[model samples]
Target: MFLLDRPTLGATWGSTSADESRVDGFYLGTYTPDKRQIVLRDSSLVTIPDAWIEHAWSAQLTLLLKDTKRRAEGHYFNIPIPRQPGSESAYFIELADPDEPVMYYTVPAGWQAEFDALPATVTVAVKEKKQGSDSWEDAITIDTIKFSRAF
Candidate 1:
C-alpha cells in the first residue's frame, strides 16, 4: 500500500557539514494516477514521463541513476503485513539524479515471513559500500546515527 498519497508536504532532513555535499533527504509527498504524475511539494506535481514507469504498484521499480561515488543505500522500516497479500513491487528511487553507476535495490523474491511488515515509519540515509568496492550496503537509518540490521 502506498503510504504517501497527496505528495504535497515534505519533512526536510538535515546533515552536518553542509559544504561537503552530503546526500540531502526529504520525505516525498504523494502520487496521483489521474494526473499521470506525483506531487512533490505543497502544490507542485512533477509529471513523471508516461513511458518511465507503468503500473508502479505492481512493477519492480528501480530508478537508473548515477552515484558520483560507489556505495549501498541504507534503509530501516518495518512492514508488518504478512505474505498473504502477495509480493507487490518495491521501488528503488533515484534522488541524486546522477549519471554513472545508477542507484538501485537488489531484493530477490522474498519469503512470506521474511518481509512481513505493517504500519511502520522509518528514516535512514542509504550509503554505499567501501570506497573502492562496487557493492552496496544496507545501513540503518536512525536520526543521524548509522546502524545495521543483518549479520
Candidate 2:
C-alpha cells in the first residue's frame, strides 16, 4: 500500500533580503522499513502500523545562506513543517536540515481528507537567534515548495 511517490525541487531567497541569501536544491523519496518506524534515509522517520504502509520516500534540500551572522555566532536556522491533520496520533520526525527528504503516509482508513486538504505549496522560512536577542527573528523567506501528489 503505497501513498505518496514523487520528486521535489525548490529554491527561495533567505530573509537576509540580500541577493546572496538564498537556498536551493532537489531530492528523491525512498522507502525503507524498520522495526520501530519507517526511516527516510538520513532525513526523517515516521511511526505507523505495517498495514498502513503505502509508500515511503526520502530527499534532501540543501541550504545556502550568505548572512553568516547567526552561524558565526553559533546559531542555526529553523525550518518549520506544519502538522498534517490526524498527525496528533502519528509520530513525525523533523530533520535539522531543510534539504533532507521527509517521509509522508497515505492511510485510506482516516487520513483521506487530511491528505486531500494538503496545501499545494508550503513556505519554508529561515529564522535565527541573534546574539543578545532572547528569541529568533525572521531572516528571509526560503523556497515555497510546491507539492504535487495524486491521492
Candidate 3:
C-alpha cells in the first residue's frame, strides 16, 4: 500500500496529515498460500520503513472495487490458481501471448466437478472510512464488476 508521507512529518496512528510534495511510502509483501503465511520485506524505496499487519488480502479486495462503484457483485470464491514451483518463468512467457486467456486459479482434480457446478456470482458489499474516523460509512450499491471467462 502506498501512503503519502515524508520522513520529517510526524502523525499518530489513524490520524491524517497533509503534505505538499509527492512522497509515498510503500510496503511490499508476498503470501505463501501453502503455509498460510505472509512475509513482508522492508523496501529500499522509502527511508522510513512501514509495517502492515492487518488483512493482507484486503488490497486485492480493494483493487477488485477499483473500476466499479463502492459496492459490486463478485464471485464468492475468487481465489487465484497458484502456479507450480519452478514454473514462474514459463508462466510469464505464457502470459506474454496475446491470444492466451488469463486464468484466475487452477482447480484440483477432486474439486473440478464441484467447482464447475458452483454459482457464477455473489454480492460484494463495500464501505469507506475517512481518515481518523472510527466508523465506516454505510454500504453503497453501485455498478457491479464485470466477470468474464478470462476471470
TM-score of each: 0.17, 0.18, 0.19
By TM-score, the candidates rank as 3, 2, 1
lDDT of model number 2:
0.25
Superposition error at 104 for model 3 (Å)? 18
Worst ten in a row by lDDT for model 1:
50-59
Count clashing pairs, candidate 2.
13
User: What is the TM-score of candidate 1?
Assistant: 0.17
Q: Regarding TM-score, does 1 or 2 come out ahead?
A: 2
Q: Is candidate 2 or candidate 3 better by lDDT?
A: 2
**Per-model CA lDDT versus the true structure:** 0.22, 0.25, 0.21
Residue range 31-136, candidate 3, lDDT tens digits? 1222222221211111111111111111122444332112112211232333335532111111112232332322331000011122333221111222223333
* 40 Cα displacement, candidate 3 (Å): 24
Query: Number of backbone collisions per candidate, in order?
Result: 22, 13, 3
Alpha-carbon shift of residue 61 in model 2 (angstroms): 40
Better of 1 and 2 by lDDT: 2
- At residue 112, give the lDDT of candidate 1: 10
What does candidate 2's lDDT look like per residue over 18-136, in tens digits? 11122311111211223333333223554432111111112333354222222111111212233335534222232224653342322323211111122323222222223223332
